[model samples]
Target: MGADYLKEMFGLEGQTAVVVGGAGVLGGALCRGLVQAGAKVIVADLMEEPCRKQVDELTQLGGQAAYVVVDVTSRESIESLLADSLKQSERIEILVNCAGVNAGNDFLDATDQDWDRIMAINLRAVFQACQVFGRHMIQAGGGKIVNIGSVTSHLPLSRVWAYSASKAAVLNLTRNVAQEFAEKGIRVNAICPGFFPAEQNRKVLTQERIDNIMHGTPMKRFGEPEELIGALLLLVSPIAGQFITGTHINVDGGFTAAWF
Candidate 1:
């Protein structure tokens, strides 16, 4: 295929993308990918410093980008993010819900607080973000939303009971929302990632757990942060992903395919 043909299919020139949780590792990579694809990116997160830092990084890379402080736990806060995004870029063409939290605890030892906190950030926040962004997209005629799920979304893992349940809910919610807005020119989908160590998961990635994950994964290794960008670009591209929705892509290194 010609370079022009490929660009035509995936170019995001003049588009604006809002990446919630863009301050963190995986989210930061997604933000950079969006920028590289020619979209003006808004790096939204809970803290100003890190969000601004991401914007700086993108700027240094010669990409159009900015930052917005957001607290995804609140619907009003999410709405404010949408408002701020519009004010900065005129419109939002894509939304990536990457803000999430996890905890590792035995099933019997999982506390109500743990479950509530995990669900609040992982599931409820995605719901609120989708509703807020989905409404705007419907009114604007079209948009793309990519929610972050996990390997636990499909398979049960030792510990992380609340995290597993929350991610599972995220996957289901993605489908339901995708179907709900299919006729309205809005696409909702998910990316279920396997074991990729980051700040959020470091607390849980003990030696024993790492050994188990490697054994379960066919590739016998963890995924690189940048490895997720291709799938993300495909789902967010207006031309390439026009008909794709209500589905998920598992970037799990065959972990979901492996069984002992």
Candidate 2:
């Protein structure tokens, strides 16, 4: 009875979820979580090869899964992703914006191109996807959206100026959109992850930086990609997260809670 009750509250048996950046490490974990919860998963990303691979893996796990190539930097491409995903599922019940990029440099050494590129993928792309998918969810009656944020969203780290700035903006945008969609039965929230070893930040996580992270993080360990699944499920689950919106979960090993 307890198991049944938990499933009733958190199971996504018939829902459809589109996970943008589903090919990446953390994103892949989020995709797996959604699928395991019983939602049909659409793996959306920039490269068809990676997206296909992710879908294949999800299918192997006994999940209904497919892929749609999306260059989040382009609005038209985002719209196309929606059209393609709708072809497979009647309506999308959840959207997870997980696509992101990063670079580290001294303030004087940052380039305009880098800043623009990071913002395009990390911040602007999220805004576009929310608007596009939010419209669909509104018409479909209701849905959930989870924007992937970073510990930087709350406490900016040194040397990753654009990434920090863009993440901060994403959290702000999540709240604003949440308010706008609250009356529409759509809940928008964010998950701020601490340091996880992902491709986007590989270049930035030098040994010294790793030490600094461990020092500030109370847990003294980097988070695993899979560790984020619980928070993701909570934010997107209709029953468990029904009353949760316009807020964020900091899954950062208490990094955000530390004082020193």
Candidate 3:
């Protein structure tokens, strides 16, 4: 009975989810969680190879899955992604924006190209995706959207200036968009993850930086990609998260808490 009740509240059976950046490590984990909860997942990313691989893995796990190649930097590409995703499912019930980039440099050394690139992927793309997908969801009656944020969303981190700034903007955007869509039965929220090793930030994680992160994190350890699944599920689940919106959950192993 307990299991049944839990499933009743959290199960995603018959839903459809589109996870942008679904090929990356943390994004892949979010996709897996959505699929396991019984939603048909559409893996959207820039590379066909990784998207295909992600679909194959999700299929192996007995989940319905498909892939759509998208360059989030382009608004037209994101619209195409929506069209392609609808080909697999009648309506998308959830959207997770997980694509991001990061670079570390002294304030004086930061390049315009790097800043633009990071903002394009990490902030602008999210805004575009939300607008595109939010329209679909509003027409479909209701849906959920989860934007990927970083611990930097709440507190500034050293060196990765653009990344920190973009993430902070993402969280702000999430709140504003949430308010816009609230009356439309669409809930928008964010998940701010602590340091999990991923391709985007690997170049920035020097030993000194690692030590500093550990010192700040009360858990004294880095989070695993899988550790974020619980919060993801909560924010996306219709029954469990129906009243939750316009806010963010910090899955940062006490990093944000320690800041206060």
Candidate 4:
């Protein structure tokens, strides 16, 4: 606490951060973390209430914030979000893609619609948000993007075929964007989370699912929304993760490492 190496390295004094899907659990935690770092936040989500709640809470805490209803599945929504943020802040320094959905299905039972919808919300949204916001970063020198993938991207999780594939795409897409944008100063990275309470899997989060997750995770515990804050900070904070890009930070409690 004396010097706070992390603080020194990752202070977001006047930066503006956009958290897509800021209403949900993990997204809300990220909003708070960035707000605490002194970044003005724009909470974008599918629902207005949740988005407003996030903005209000941050404002109550004396942090700057704004909210907009965004359908990550739409290019227009994504474009408007970036346009509005720029109009308001003149600059956007961070973009975090936390909006995603799980396509619940066995690999063999998965339908084309199921796969497309999952990819649209999870994988495609990330790309849309990046391109829309990335243009500004490219114009203004540079920016940082932190995309949320899943641990399943690396390890197959049954009954979520499309979800897993979409996240896998996200991981690869992060690397590709990082390589293309590195010269532009736009660093791209991803966070592959194990599990947490959120809207993405509300329908599938049963006791059986919880037990299955615990069995796979070495820690035998599901992650908390707050647990993601540190990793997110390390990635988006310009000084902290300046050199860290094109990598996926797994916050899954060693879920991918345990086999036995």
User: Of models 3 and 4, which has the larger TM-score?
Assistant: 3
Q: Which parts of model 4 have CA positions greater than 4 angstroms off?
A: 1-6
Task: Give a tens-digit lDDT track for model 4, residues 1-260.
Answer: 55577577888988999999888888999999999888999998999888888899999888999987899888998998888888779899999999877756657876788888888989888988888889989998999999998887686677877777788889999999999899999999998888887776777787888988888888988889989999998998878778998998889899887843
- TM-scores vs. true structure, each candidate: 0.98, 0.98, 0.98, 0.94
- In terms of lDDT, model 4 sits at 0.87
At residue 34, give the lDDT of candidate 2. 91
What digit string (tens of lDDT, one per residue) describes model 3 on residues 1-260? 69888898899999999999999999999999999999999999999999999999999999999999999999999999999999999999999999988888889987889889999999999999999999999999999999999999988898987899999999999999999999999999999999998887689999998999999999999999999999999999879889999999999999999998
Native-referenced Cα lDDT, model 2: 0.94
lDDT of each: 0.91, 0.94, 0.94, 0.87
Cα deviation at 134, candidate 1, in Å, is: 0.8
Residue runs of model 1 more than 4 Å from their true location after superposition: none
Model 1 root mean square deviation, Cα atoms: 1.0
lDDT at position 246, candidate 2: 99
Candidate with more favorable, higher TM-score: 2 or 4: 2
In angstroms, the error of model 4 at 181 is 0.4
Give the local distance difference test score of model 1.
0.91
